[model samples]
Target chain A: MDRLSEVSASLVGGFEYNCIIFFCTLVMAVPLGLVITFGSMSRFKPLKWVSKTFVWIIRGTPLMLQLFVVLYAPGLIFDIPIKSRMTAVLIAFVINYAAYFSEIYRGGIESIPKGQYEAGQVLGLTKPQVFFKVVLFQVIKRVIPAMGNEIITLVKDTSLARIIGVTEIIMCAERFTKQGLIWPLFSTGLFFLAFCGILTLLFGYIEKKLDYYKG
Target chain B: MSILEVNNIHKSFGKTKVLQGVDFTMERGEVLVILGSSGSGKTTLLRCLNFLETADKGKIFVDGRLIFDADNKQKPSRAEIRERQLNFGLVFQSFNLFPQYSALENVTLAPKLLAKERADFKRNKAAIYDEIEKNAIALLDDVGLKDKMNNYPCELSGGQQQRVSIARAMAQDPKILFFDEPTSALDPELTGEVLKIIRSLAAEHKTMVIVTHEIEFARNVADKIVFMSEGVIVEQGAPEEVIDHPKQERTRAFLNKLSK
Candidate 1:
């Protein structure tokens, strides 16, 4: 029982890495995704093509492969090694999720009727003003459900950071398998399940807060 | 000078010509109603005048200032376009209120945004916002929505939503207001409320260009009426001459069909 308690505490400590990656990726990716969405929807053909193609490339490949490339590519191709494993994990996760979020953002933004834009225009609003003032919140209300799904997936995807040696929760639990204790590895599931439960509740509360407006 | 002059406007979507050689003028405070059936380019004409769509060829002058001239090869800047668009207000067939904002917010949004451009906005923000809110409340009350000022568009009836949109347009205090089939989206029983607001606006001597199919309402409110067919004006004159006694065969046929 003492061994189990000690192993559980170690796993909890390792879980901090997962939480850090999740929050760091989210903070960077959400706004970056919006920027990419604007790029993909740009009226200028070259910028639109570049953004679309980049999104396609990121979404088509496996994120595990992206993790490998981000960790090793600089060293192999340019002879300048990445100094920190955590930085590589953050870079890979942020880029991967940003590509996913951008498509969801595009869907939400395009769902708005053209009349909304025309109404703003006829009221003498500049295009940027129309977007920020009239359309942005509507888009937020629409994209929330899809974003919730992606964010939950992101919490699980943080385990992938272990591939580049970031020592997330699962990896810390795996150390107990070497000591002939299997239950500690299985016990990590409780942490994930509880975390996801809390996230689900959080998303549900956010959705209700925005319920005053129908998207 | 005429309050508005459109000299030979033309617009096309690829090969489908929508507005071809359309010309008209309106005196200040004149209610000019454009009457036509579907696909008759009435809405497109209103869009062009409101700068929602660019005309292929035309010159639009409001109060003797040239707003749009396809003859000028230089494209106007964004600020210039916005400045020109401020001269007109457009109410859509579908009431496109920002669903997230309340009725008073909808009415005050544009005026508040425009107020931010004032030189003293930063120092006088509270006073300016209070004044704008006061005006918005007055406008909503004018449209008989004083009690429903806090309702969202989804919460309001279709007629009430349309009235809120009318109040929104009037908040801009535009020189010329354009309506594109305002009641077409409302139920027949509900249209009376919206039409009554417009009738009251006309009584206030507000200059308006309305594109509608309601013949009796047009006759009641229009100072001048322009009848359009196949992307061109078939006839235009006083409401009596056009609605009651149209001279052109096409106009006579259209009025005949509508009356039936």
Candidate 2:
């Protein structure tokens, strides 16, 4: 029992890295995703094409390979020193998740009828004001469910950071397996279930809060 | 000068012309009711007047302030057009209230937003909000939705929703209001409530241009009536003269068809 407790205590330190990767990626990616969504939806043809192709490449490639490229490309191709492995994992995860979230944002934006925009126009609202005041929260309400699914997937995806030399919980648990202890590895699943359960509850509460918006 | 003047309006949708060389002028506080069949360009003419749809050829002036002049080589900028749109209010058949806003918020949104944009609003923020809230409540009450101030659009009935739409347009303090098939989407039983609200608005002598299929309501409320067929105005006159004794054969035939 003491050994399990000791293992759990050590895993907590490793799990901190996983939590940091998850939150940093999310905080950076969501706004970045909206920015990319605007770029993809821009009226300027070249900008739209470039933004779409960038998202396509990021979404098409394996996150593992992207991590490798982001981590090593600077050193090999440009001779620039990369001092932080966490920076590498964060950049790869942020770019990958941003592309996925951008598509979700696009779908949410497009689902709004044109008449809604026209209604705002007739009210003398500027385009930006119309988007922020009338459409932004509604878009957030619509994309929340899709975003919730992606966020839950992100909890598990944090394990990918371990492969990039970040000693996250799974990696810490793997050390115990090497010492002929498998229970700690199994306990990692419980940790993940707790994390995902909290996220699911949070999203469900948000959905109920926005229930007034039927569309 | 008339309150609104549209000279030689023309519109086309692909191969089919929708509004062909339409000319019109409305006096202040005159309720002009347009009547026509579904494909007869009545809604198109109304939409064009409100700048919701741009006419291929036309010039619009509201109280001698030029709103749109398609014939001019130097076109007005987009900002100019949007500024003119603020002078008019449009109500859709679908009651297109923001699904997210409460009934009162729907009425207050534009006015509140416009107030906030002024440089001096920050100095008198509370007063501005209070004034808007007061007007919103009054308008909601006027439309018989005093209790529905907190209800979202989806929560309201079709008749109640259309009533809310009328209040929303009235909230803008528009010089002229335009309605396109306001009660067309409502159930036959629900339309009476909407028509009643409009009848009261007409009694107030508010300038209005309405496109509707309600012949009796038109006869009761219209200061003048226009009859259109196939993208052209066949005739326009006092409701009694047009509805009871239309001069054109097309007008007579349409009135006959509607009564039958």
Which prediction has the highest DockQ against the true structure?
1
Top of the candidates by TM-score: 1
What tens-digit string does per-residue lDDT give for candidate 1 at A1-215? 88767987899899999999999999999999999999999999999999999999999999999999999999999999999999999999999999999999999999999989988989999888999999999999999999999999999999998898999999998988998988888888888889889999999999999998674
* Reference-based TM-score, model 1: 0.99
Per-residue lDDT of candidate 2, residues A1-215 (tens digit) = 89967998978988898899999999999999999999999999999999999999999999999999999999999999578999999999999999999999999999988878888887778889899988988899999999999999999999998887999999999999999999888888988999999999999999999996687
Chain A TM-score relative to the true structure, per candidate: 0.98, 0.98
Off by over 4 Å in 1: none
**Per-structure clash totals for the candidates:** 0, 0
Per-residue lDDT over B38-99 for candidate 2, one digit per residue giving the tens place of the 0 to 100 score: 89999888788777788899899999888788877676676776689878999999888899
lDDT per residue (tens digit) for residues B1-260 in model 1: 99999999999999999998999999998999999888999999998898888899989999999999988989899879888988999899998999999999999999999999999999999999999999999999999999999998989999999999999999999999999999999999999999999999999999999999999999999999999998999999999999888889989888888888
Specify the CAPRI tier of model 2: medium
Colliding pairs, model 2: none
Task: In model 2, state the lDDT of residue B84.
Answer: 91
Computed on C-alphas against the true complex, the DockQ of each candidate is 0.85, 0.65
